[model samples]
Target chain A: AQRVTQPEKLLSVFKGAPVELKCNYSYSGSPELFWYVQYSRQRLQLLLRHISRESIKGFTADLNKGETSFHLKKPFAQEEDSAMYYCALKGGTSGSRLTFGEGTQLTVNP
Target chain B: EPEVTQTPSHQVTQMGQEVILRCVPISNHLYFYWYRQILGQKVEFLVSFYNNEISEKSEIFDDQFSVERPDGSNFTLKIRSTKLEDSAMYFCASSVGQGGGYGYTFGSGTRLTVV
Candidate 1:
């Protein structure tokens, strides 16, 4: 079965502190991994995809196949970073449907 | 920017009542999907629609659930008989899906409350 796991349900960080949200996946074949973010009263939007290897809003996530992980990282957390983060997987043996993790609620303190 | 829009930002209905959630996908998107997130739970995939037909669905999308693109741009998900467990925030998503690695655009989502 295809599954995405985000062990931490909530992560609290202070401004200027580094933030790292862990995400892991289980799938028989290679799957495209993504990080999505939802800010207060905002729609869910894609943050970054592993294949793109590009950073968005100062956030980056690298897909580690051997570890089956795609942990999102940011050098500095800002008050604006407070939101819900979800790790999602799509395509592969699982097909085109997306499978999402339990998501981590990120709270950046002022 | 073009966005996927869901109507009736929130809905309240009694259990066993049939309800329909509506969505207008990005104009150029070819793939559409429905997902629900119950409070305090993981977001779960319900179904995917393409070419005016269901291309894929998860176990959660059983007989009670159905998706239709009744018109050119609007996509709809219908629950024949909603249960208490059906109360959730339903998100509608659309993807250009021309090739691999394309991301989706999600709607603001409709929060359904089953009484």
Candidate 2:
């Protein structure tokens, strides 16, 4: 079975400080990882995907196969960056559904 | 941008009553899915739909649950008998390609509260 674990349930950082939300997964095959963000009163949206290797809103996550980790990181946290972040994994199969982590509620304090 | 839309932002119902959650997937998208998140719990997959039939469903999706794409764009999830444990935020998602790897557009979600 595919599973995702986000260690931190809540994290807080001062503005301009670095933030890292840890995520680990247990999957047999090569899995695609993604970071989804949900702002207050807003719908969940994709922040970044491992396959794309692109950063969104100053956030980036690297997929480490050896460690089975896909940690979301940002150089500097902003007040507006406060939101709920979820790590999701998708298997190689066509009809594979996403297995999501428990999610991290990040608060960036100004 | 194209997106998925869900109706009834919030619903409060009595236990054992039936409830139907509606969604309007992107017009060009072919795959539809339903997922829910209980309070403080991880998001879980309920079912997936393709070609007007269920393609995959999780153990949480029992006989009491059913899905249908009645027309061209509307997809609905019907829960036969609502339980107190069924209270959660239900999300409807759609993707253009085969799996979640292609990225999915999720609706704002419908918060169901069973009393």
Each candidate's TM vs. the true structure? Answer: 0.97, 0.97
Q: Write the per-residue lDDT of candidate 2 for residues B1-115, one digit (tens) a residue.
A: 8879999999999999999999999999888999999988999999999888999999999999999998888999999999999999999999888644588899999999999
Could you report the DockQ of all the candidates, in the order they appear? Answer: 0.76, 0.66
DockQ of 1: 0.76
- Taking the tens digit of each residue's C-alpha lDDT, what string does model 1 give over A20-64? 999999987888999999998788999999988998989999999
Superposed Cα deviation of residue B87, candidate 1 (Å): 0.6
lDDT of 2 at B67: 97
Inter-residue clash pairs, candidate 2: none
The runs of at least 3 residues in candidate 2 whose Cα sits more than 4 Å from the true structure, single-residue gaps closed, are none
Ten-residue region with minimum lDDT total, candidate 1 chain A: A90-99
Compute the lDDT of residue B76 as modeled in candidate 2.
98
TM-score of chain A of each: 0.97, 0.97
